[model samples]
Target chain A: MPAVVIGLADDPDQLSQDLQSPYPILPVGALFSASERQHLSDQYTPVEFAAACKPRFLNAVFARYPTVETLLYADPNVLFLHSTQPILDRLRNQTLLLTPYLLQAPGDTGPGKKAWPDEKHLQNIGLYNADFLAFTRSTETTQLLSWWQSRAETRAYIDFCKGLCTDQIWLMHAPVFFGGITIVHDPSWHVALWNLPQRQLHQRETTWQLADNGQPVLFVNMKGLFNPDEGFFPHQTRLNPAKRPDVMALLQAYRQQVAAKELAALTAIRPAYGMKPLLPVVRGWRRTATTALTALNKWVDTIYLPALPR
Target chain B: MTLAFTICSINYLAQARTLGDSLRRTNPDYQYVIGLVDKLSTANLPADLVPDYPMLEVDKIGIPDFQAMCDRYDITELNTAVKPFFIDYFYKNRPEATAVIYFDPDIIVFQPLTELNKALETNSLILTPHTCSPTPDWERPNELHHLNTGVFNLGFIGLRTDKIARAFVDWWKERLVYECRIDLCEGLFVDQHWVNFAPAYYQNVCIDKYLGYNVAYWNLHERQFSQRPDGTWLINETDELRFFHYSGYNPFRPDDISKYQTRYTFSQRSDVKPLFDLYCRELLANANEQYTKYPCVYIKPPTIKRYQRVRKAIKLPINRLISLLQHR
Candidate 1:
C-alpha cells in the first residue's frame, strides 16, 4: 500500500484555509492559548502555536502507527515541487528528508546593501526553512518524539527568538544528534519562498512553461507570501513605497494564477527586485544525480560516520 | 633536462608585482627561469628578448593566477598586471613540454628544487598547498581545526605533460578561465581550493608534501626555530627545509632590516627582514643611493578610537578567523 503522509503547520489557521491538498489534513491545536501568552505578546505573532499544536498532533500519530515508516511527515507550507515521481523516488529508501536554510552569517546585516547595522537582529538561524520536513518510523524519530514531548510541555519560548515556536526548536540538532536517516535540502523536493530558497524560485522562473506538461510541482513553499491584505509580495521582500502598489498587484495576480492553474498568466508575473543570481540546477539529472547526491550525503556523515569512524 | 620552473615575473620590483623575483631568487637559476608576461605580442618582442622563458596573460591554461582570481597584487586592484596579447600568442604556439613551474613573483626560492623533480617521478599531476592539516581554528592553534591549506600560495607547482597531468591542468584552467570570480564562495575566489578534490575528479592528481616543498607562514606554531648543529635551520622537529617562504612582514623601508627592529610599514622584500637578502642583493647593494631615506614610518590615523578597541576588534577576531580557515 502507498504510504500516507501529512504536512503539519500552524499560523493557528494557515493549514485550515489551505486544507485542500491531495493529502488528508489535520489542524494542530494551539499549544498555548492567547491568555497563556499574556506574559509576552507579539505586535503580531504565532506566539504559542507549536507548544500547543505539535506534540498533541505527533502523539496522536505515534499512538496510532506501530512505526513511523508507514507514514511521511511534511511541513504545511510546502507545495509539490517536481512530478510526484521524484518524491516517490526518494521514498524508495529514506526515512527522513529535510532542506537546510541559510543561517544568519554571524555578521550578515541582511541579504543586500541597505543591510543597516541596526537591522542586525539574530545571527543567521540557518535551520529556518523549518517549513519542509519529513519523518519516517525509526528509533531516531521515536527517540526524537520522546524528547520533544517532554520539552514542549515546558519551555514555551526563549528570546534570541523571532517568536517562540516548538517544531523548529525541537530540531536544534536533529541531523547530528539523531541516529541518522535521509534529510535533504533538495531544491527539486521543496523550497522556501524567500532568502536562499529564493534561488530555487528564480530557477523555476521559466519552469511554469515546463510544468504544463503534467510535471509535479514537487513542493513549492509559498510560506513567506501569505499576508492576507498584502496577499503575496514574497516573505522578507522589501519594495519602495512608490512602486509598492504595482508590485503587490502583480504578485497578487500571480498567486491567483497559481491557484487557478493558469500557467501562462503566472509566467507574466515579474520577479522581485534583487541581485543575487538564481542558483542553477542541472536539469534532466534531477531524478538521477540530484536526488542520489542529496540522499547519499546525509547518510555518509551524520548517521553512519559516528558508528564507523570512531 | 627532466624539468625546470618557468616563472612569468613581469616588472617584479615595481609595487605593481608580487614575489616573482623572490620566486626566481630561491636558488641560483630562479631569475633565469622567469620571463615577464608582457603587453607585446611575439611579433612585437624586441629582437634580443627571445621568449626563452614562458609568460602567460589570459585567465587560462598555464596562467592559473590571473586577474579574475585575485583582488590585488598585494592589495592592488584588479587588471593591474594584464598582458592582453600574451595569451593569443602562447595559446596558439606554446609547446606541450615535459614540466612547468609557475611561481608567484614575490616568492623567494631559498634552494634549488632537486627533490621536487624526484617527487614527481611517478608522472602524476603534482600540486602543493601551504598547510593541509584541516584545523577548526587557526587563532587557537592548539584547536583540532587549525588545519590550514597552503594551496593559495601559487609560488611553486610541478607539472608534467603526460595525459593525466595535462587533463588535471586543463580542468584547473577551465575553472579559472571561465568561472573565476573573487566574490564567489566566501571570497576564496581563486579556484585553487579545487586542488583539494581535483585528485578525485582527475585520475592522476596528487597532494604534494605539506612541510618541505610548499612551506608558508601559517605553519609556524608554538615551536620556534634556530640555526641547527648541522648548519641547517631547525624548527621544532626537522630542519631539512626545502624552501622558506617570506610571505608577510616584508621590510618596506630597507632600514627595517638594518637595525633588526620591526616597523609599521609596507615595502618590497628589499626593505624587510633578512628574508630576502639574497634576492635583493643587487637592489640593496645600491639601496644606499636610490632609496637612501631610512627610518620611514607608516602611521595611519587610527580607525578605532582606542588601543583597547584594536585588540577588541581586528586582532582577536582576525586570529579566530584564520583558525577557522585552517579548521576546514
Candidate 2:
C-alpha cells in the first residue's frame, strides 16, 4: 500500500516531509522527468495540473510495483476507519470499481435533503464517485485510465455546460463503453456528505456500522465538511451538520487533523509548472460573466455549428 | 424475428434514408423495410437512389383500390392510412417475422432496441405517450393538446404476431381505411388519436414510459441528457437514449431542433442540440436538398393559378362566416 502524495504546493519537499504514513510517500515532482513536466505544464490549469497528476502518479506506481495486482487511487481528503482488506478482496475479480452517490434516489421528505443532489444534480456531477477508485493492472484498466487521462488533459473543470466536473463526469459512461463496470453499492465502502441522507454512520463497538444495515463502515470521504473557524468550504453548500450528530465525532477528528495540517500556510501555493494563476476574485468575476457566452461559442463550434455531429 | 418499417412517400425518402442508416448502425439484426405510399413514376429520380433496405410500394402490399385510396387522401392522411395495412402485410407475408415495429421516417435510433424487443417478448402491442410525465410549464399544447391530437405518438409503435396484435391490426385497418383524416372537428388526427383506448381495448398492451425511448421536443423538458466519455448518450442519468423522434424538424432551419414545439431552444435547452446536428448531417448526406424537389407522384404539388387565387380570396370571408355560424 504505497501511497503517492501529490503536492500542489510551491514547495512539495516541505509538504512531503510533514506527512507521516505507514506506506512510502512518493512526491510527484520527483517522479516526473523534466520533459514530462514541460509537456504537462503546457496543457493544464493549476487545478487541472494537480488533478491530472493522479493518473500519471498511478502509472508510475504501477511501474515501480510490478508485483502488486491491484492499485487504489483515493483522494487525499478521504479518511479510513477500518482495514482495506475487504476492498482488496472485492477488487480481486474486477478490473475497475466505482461507487454511486446514492443507492436510491433520496426523497424530498428530509430536512435540506429534497432540494439538491437530486436527479439532475447527480447527472451533472456524475453517476459514480471518483473519491475512491481501484484498478487491477491489466489491459482494460490501462485503457480505461488512458481514456480518463485524455479527457482530463483537455477539459477537467467544474463547467456544467461542457459536461465536466474534473475527471469525475467522464466516469458516467465507463460502464457502458468499457464493456461493463462494477459499481460498488456497498454502503460501507466510500461514504460522503452527498450520500449521508441515505447512509447513517453509527459508532458500534470497536467499529462504525452503517445504520441502515449492519455493514461495517470502512471510510468516510470528508468531501464537503468545513471547519467554520478556518473558513474554507467545499463545492457543495447544503450539508447540514445538525442533521448528522451520529457522525460528529468523525467530523471533529477530521477537522482537527485538517487544522493540524496548517492548510492556511500552503493556501497561496500554486503548481510549479502550469498556466498563470488568476486571483480567485478575478476568476469568479470573469467566470460568472463569461461562462454563458463561452458555452454558446463552444456549442457552436463543437455541437451547434459543428462540421460533424459529436 | 422482428421486422420494422416506416411509411412515407417519395418526398420523405431522405428522412427514410436517414432512419434506415441509423437502424443499420444501432439495431442491425432486425430486417428493416420501408412502405412507400407512392408510385415509382419516371420523373422521380429518387427511385434510382432508393435505400438499400427492401421497400414495399403501395400497390405491392395487396390492398384493394390502393390507387383510389392514394388519390383521395392527402399526403399526411395517405402516409398514416397505410400504416395498419403495412403491419398486416408484413405479419401475414413474412412467415419468419414474430414481431413488427414502426418508426416515423424522421426518427433516428441511437441505441440497441433491447427494451422494445423485451417488451414485445411478453406483450403483443406497445405504444409511447406524447409524454410520460406532465409538463410543469403550463402553456398551450399541454396534456390537453396531447389528449386532443393523440395520447399515443403513432410515430413509433411495436406489434407482435399474436392474437391481440392481429385483432388490433384488423380493427385499426377498418377505421383507417375510411377515417384517416386530419379533421379536428370529427375528433380525428390520422391514425394516432384512435390508439388512446389501446390499453383498455387490448389484452397485452404496454405503454412503454422508458425515459430513453421515443424522446422528442414535446418530451424534452422531462428528459435530461449527458454524454459518456466514449460519446454515447444517456437520458435522466440511468437509461441509454434508445431513439429520438425528430418530429417537425426542418433541415433548412438547422439552428432550431424542432419547428413544432417552442418549449425548447438551442441556448437554454442545449442537451438535445447534438442530436439535431447529427440528424441534420444524416438527412443532408442522404440527399435532402435533392430529394425535396421531387414531389410525390400521387399527391400533386398544388399549383396556384392566378384566377383560382382570386376566386378563393373573394369567397374567403363568406366561408369563414359560414364556419363560425355552424360552430355556433
Identify the candidate with maximal DockQ.
Answer: 1
- Per-candidate clashes come to 62, 0
TM-score each candidate: 0.37, 0.48
Off by over 4 Å in 1: A1-310, B2-11, B14-96, B134-152, B184-188, B222-224, B229-231, B253-328
DockQ by candidate, in order:
0.02, 0.01
Lowest lDDT block of 10, candidate 1 chain B:
B141-150
Per-residue lDDT of B253 in model 1: 44
Please state what fraction of the native interface contacts candidate 2 reproduces. 0.00
| Model 1 whole-model lDDT (C-alpha atoms) | 0.40
List the lowest-lDDT window of 10 residues for candidate 2 chain A.
Answer: A227-236
lDDT of 2 at A11: 32
lDDT at residue A2 of model 1 (Cα atoms): 49
lDDT per residue as tens, model 1, B1-328: 3323332323232211223343445544432333443333422434443333444433333444554334333221122122212222232344543455555444544456777666666646566644433222424321111111113335555665566665555444443443333322122234443343343334455556535554444444322344456745444456355665544423454433222122222243222233445435534432322322221111123233333443344345444544344333
